[model samples]
Target: MQFLVKSARPETLKTATLVVAIGEGRKLGAAARALDAASEGTLSALLKRGDLAGKPGQTLLLQGLAGVKAERILLVGCGKERELSERSYRKVAAAALAVLKTLGGSDAALTLGELMVKGRDAYAKARLLVEVLADGGYVFDRFKGDKAEAPALTRITLLAEDTDLLACERGAAHAQAIASGMAFARDLGNLPPNLCHPSFLADEAKALAKGNKALKVEVLDEKKLKELGMGAFLAVAQGSEQPPRLIVLDYKGGKKDDAPFVLVGKGITFDTGGISLKPGLGMDEMKYDMCGAASVLGTFRALVELGLPINVVGLLACAENMPSGGATRPGDIVTTMSGQTVEILNTDAEGRLVLCDTLTYAERYKPQAVIDIATLTGACIVALGSHTSGLMGNHDGLIRQVLKAGETAADRAWQLPLFDEYQEQLDSPFADIANIGGPKAGTITAACFLSRFAKKFHWAHLDIAGTAWVSGGKDKGATGRPVPLLTQYLLDRCQ
Candidate 1:
């Protein structure tokens, strides 16, 4: 879709569709009031006849109005004006787009960016408008015999005042890049396990670097992994016929000597829980285990598109976990790249095994900070549900930076305690530490396990098990989360 920001009057802007906001109690927004006055109280008459209730997400469509140049007028309810919020504003935008999709129009002009959203400026509002529309229009029917029909609406013009035009334009551009990144991430996550295995992800990395001089790609095979003593990562891949891969993406947009920010992603392409098999039911969703890896690639795509001047590295610990004769079993001990021994009491707890090795590998970059993203534990789902990602880290400042980035992008994370006391849960009499940190506080213990290898640098972990994808429904698909948050963090760093 194409997005534009322009200074235009609502009553005179010529477009296939004109979307304006309406507050509760029949209150018209600034744009709506202008259109109402131009049409000699046409909207007021509709409100008097009780044609539309000004509730959030409600909509009323008017066609061929006398004074309106637009072919159609869409009045979207935004609840009370003073109570307008980011969440409600998103609802209003989404509602308007949902209606626009059904119409015959191919272009739209939205005034929602002009509405006041608490704590948000014109740039934020415009950015959010594009993000919401892109999200609603995303469809994954690549494998379907008959693909879903695409939406007719393609061009979206954000109508803003002259003073706000530049800010809105910047937001639209940023949002377009972010949306493309999200679509890439979602595609990788939604692919079938057979097609999106470890090697496949390695190819994707190479493809992303094909013509981009700012990026360099490298893939470490099993031989290199063995040479580097990545036993824990290798053990997870031993059961699968497909080879494992450690995919690295280097982006240098800043000074050569600048310490890069590193992102490590657990790329368990297909997780069958190895020797400790998961329940047969809902196991199909395990393909999304690599959402963490997808998100990293997604962030890189956005960063490169925006041409942000920052040195960054992305590491993908890609593997497939299956329960074969050669698979690592419970009670097995494996050495990690960090030289730390892990006693695997539950093979299902394999995400951290790969991440531990990768986290140790990240120390080579002398990174500014490292953040690992993974679908690490179901306990995170139980604790935080699907609304927020679970966050835990060793450094307080880095954690706060990441937390604030999530808020700014509207992709939130709730920090879990990484207290020293939780480290005891991974105690194993046989090895340095246990892979499964008992049952209680599974989320925190998982972070605690990775924390051991990350002591060399400032590190934070995002457990995205719940927020990665929706399970078993019409809406089931990868959410492409944390990409927005991660990209926003990088964007903030550039400032």
Candidate 2:
């Protein structure tokens, strides 16, 4: 899809469709008022006749209004004029785009970017508008025999004032990059396990680096992993016929000497809980197990596109945890690259096993900070539901920075306590620590397990088990979360 910035009155812009906002109390915003007057109070008359109520998410479509050049007009409810929050404004934008999608128009001009959102600037408004459009416009029918026709709404023009045009353009560009990154992540997560294995992930990473001078890709096979003493990570891969991979992506866009921000991801391409096998029910959704890794690659895709002036390294601990004779079983112990021993009381607790080894590897970078993303525990889903990623970290300052990034991006994270008390649950008499920290505070314990390996750097962990993907319903697919948050954090630092 294409995006543009238009600096003109809504009624004067010639387009297939014109989108404007109406407040809940039947009050029209500036653009809507101008168009309404041009059409001799057509919007007001329709509201009075009960044809349209300006409730949030409510939309009305009118064709060939008296004085409008556009073939159609879409009126989206923005809730109360005085109470138009950012969230509500997003809803308004979504509603407007929904109408445009069904109109079969080639393009449309939206003036909703002019609407005032509390504490949000014109750039943010424009960015959110295009971001919503790109997200909503996503279609994943590649596997469908009877695929739907391509959407007719291909180009979108966001109306903004002359003074705000540059910011709007910048915001739109960033939003497109982010949305494309999200789409990339979702595509990787939604691929069938048969298709998106460890090798496939490595290939994808290499493909991403192709022709991109700013990015470099490297992959480590089973032999290389063993040479590096990643026994914990190798244990998970031994069960799968497809070998494991430690995928590294180096994005060098900053000053030559700057210490890079390192990101580690647990890439359990298809986790069947290893020998401690998960129930058959919902096991198919395990394809999303690698979403953490997908997010890292996705963030790189965006950062490279934005040409962000910040060094970043993505370390993906890619492997498959299948239940086979070779699979690491309960009561097994494996040593990590850090030479730290971990008791594998349950094979299903393998994400941390993969991450522990990789986290230790990350210290070699001497990074400014290291953040690992993983769908590490179901307990995180139970605690935070599917809306927010569970955040835990050893460094309060880095944790707060990530939390703030999540907030700014609306890809939020709720910080769970990383208190030393939670670390006690990970104690093991047999080894340096145990992989599973018994069931209580399971998410924190998982983070605690990784914290031990990340002590050398400013580190934070995002347990995205809940927010990574949906398990059922029509919307069941990868959400491509935290990419927005992670990207925003890097972007902020670049500034």
Candidate 3:
């Protein structure tokens, strides 16, 4: 979708439709006195009942205002004025797009622009809401046989007639980059895992890197994996005929030799639980296992698009864990790219296997800090629920940065403990450590296992297992999450 900003009067807009967020009692911020006279009671009576101003995410539509040029007006609620924050207002923007899904118009305007943001500047707030509307408007029905053509939504004009509006304009460019990148992320996640296997994902990364002067990408195949002693990661790929791939994407917008921020993502295209096997009940959702990789790849593309003044390198470890005789079985011992042997007690505990070796590869970069996201454990869902992700890390500063970023992006996360005691559960009698670290605090032990390979650098782990795929049917699957959070965080705090 294209976005534009103009100083045209709301009455002068000759588009097929207009969208403005309003309240329940027809309460509205005066649009600088002039339009107020022409609008008359249209704004007032609309707010009289079923007004769009009652709360965030609430919306009502008004047709043919007395003297307005637009045919229809989309009134979206912004909640109480005092209660509106940047995040809340972003929700309002997202709600606006959601309400417009079936409206059949091409151009729209958000005249109801105001900020509920604090601490962050007007630039950041404006950038955030525009980005939110772009991200939330995504719809994925790729293979649906019977689907309506998506409505033609070409432009969203955010009105900036107020005093602090310059900040919103300043944020507009960055917001454009964010929304474009997120739309790319949504496409990656929505593609069928079969069509988007390991090699395909590597090709996509390479294609993206090839187009940019500031970025470079490399794809490593099985032979390279063998040379690196990535037995643990390879063990999970044994069952698939489709070759395993390690994709590394590097963005250099900083000092030529500066150590970069490293990001790692788990790329399990289709996980059949290998030899351990999962019940057939909800197995279809496993396609989202690669959400972490999609997020990382999406962030990489976005950073390059935004031309961020920071150096970053991203690694996506791709493999398909299936059930074949060649697959690693329970009780097998395999060493990682870091040269640490891990006992495979459960084939289903495979995500860390990929992430551990990938983390090991990040060490070669000598990064300033490292952060990895994965659909690592179900226990995270049990602990934090679907609303938030579980965060655990050895470095407090890194984790705090991630948590703060999450809050700013509106994709929240709760920090979970990484106690020394959690490491004990992974201890193996026969090898250096065990892959499946029993039942208690499964999420922490998984982080502990990855920590074994992520030595020295400030590193943080996000267990997005629960938040990656929303099984509730109410929410769209693969939240296209942590992409916005990770990207926004790096843009803000990584400098």
Q: Over 4 Å off in model 3, which ranges?
A: 32-34, 45-58, 85-91, 115-121, 162-166, 472-476, 493-495
Model 1, 1-495: lDDT tens per residue? 888889989899999999988888888889988988999998888888877778999999988578999999998988876857889988998899889999999999999876788888988988988899988788999989998887888898999999998999999899888988899999999999989999999999899889999999999999999999999999999998989999999999999999999999999999999999999999999999999999999999999899999999999999999989999989999999888899999999999999999999999999999999999999999999999999999999999999999999999999999889999989999999999878799999999999999999999999999998999889999999989999999999999
Tens-place lDDT per residue, model 2, 126-213, is: 8877888898888788799999888888899988889999999998999999999999999999999999999999999999999999
Off by over 4 Å in 1: none
**Candidate 3: lDDT of 188?**
78
Model 1 local distance difference test score: 0.93
lDDT of 3 by residue, 1-495 (tens): 777766677777776567665543445654412334677765665465543445777877767676778777776766666547665776777777887776878887777554445656656666776777776677777788987676787777777766656777768877777666667766777688779899999988988888698899899999999999999999999988878999998899988988999989899998889999999987878888888998888888778878888899989999998998788899999988777898999999999999999998998899989999999998998888898988988788888888888887777889988888889999899999999789999999999999898877889999998887678465657777788788878787545
Q: lDDT of all predictions, in order shown?
A: 0.93, 0.90, 0.81
Inter-residue clash pairs, candidate 2: none
lDDT score, candidate 3: 0.81
- What's the true lDDT of residue 384 in model 1? 98
Residues forming the 10-long window of minimal summed lDDT in candidate 2: 77-86
Clashing pairs in 1: none
- Count of backbone clashes for each model? 0, 0, 14
Query: Model 3: how far is 60 from its true place, Å?
Result: 3.8
TM-score of candidate 1 relative to the true fold: 0.99
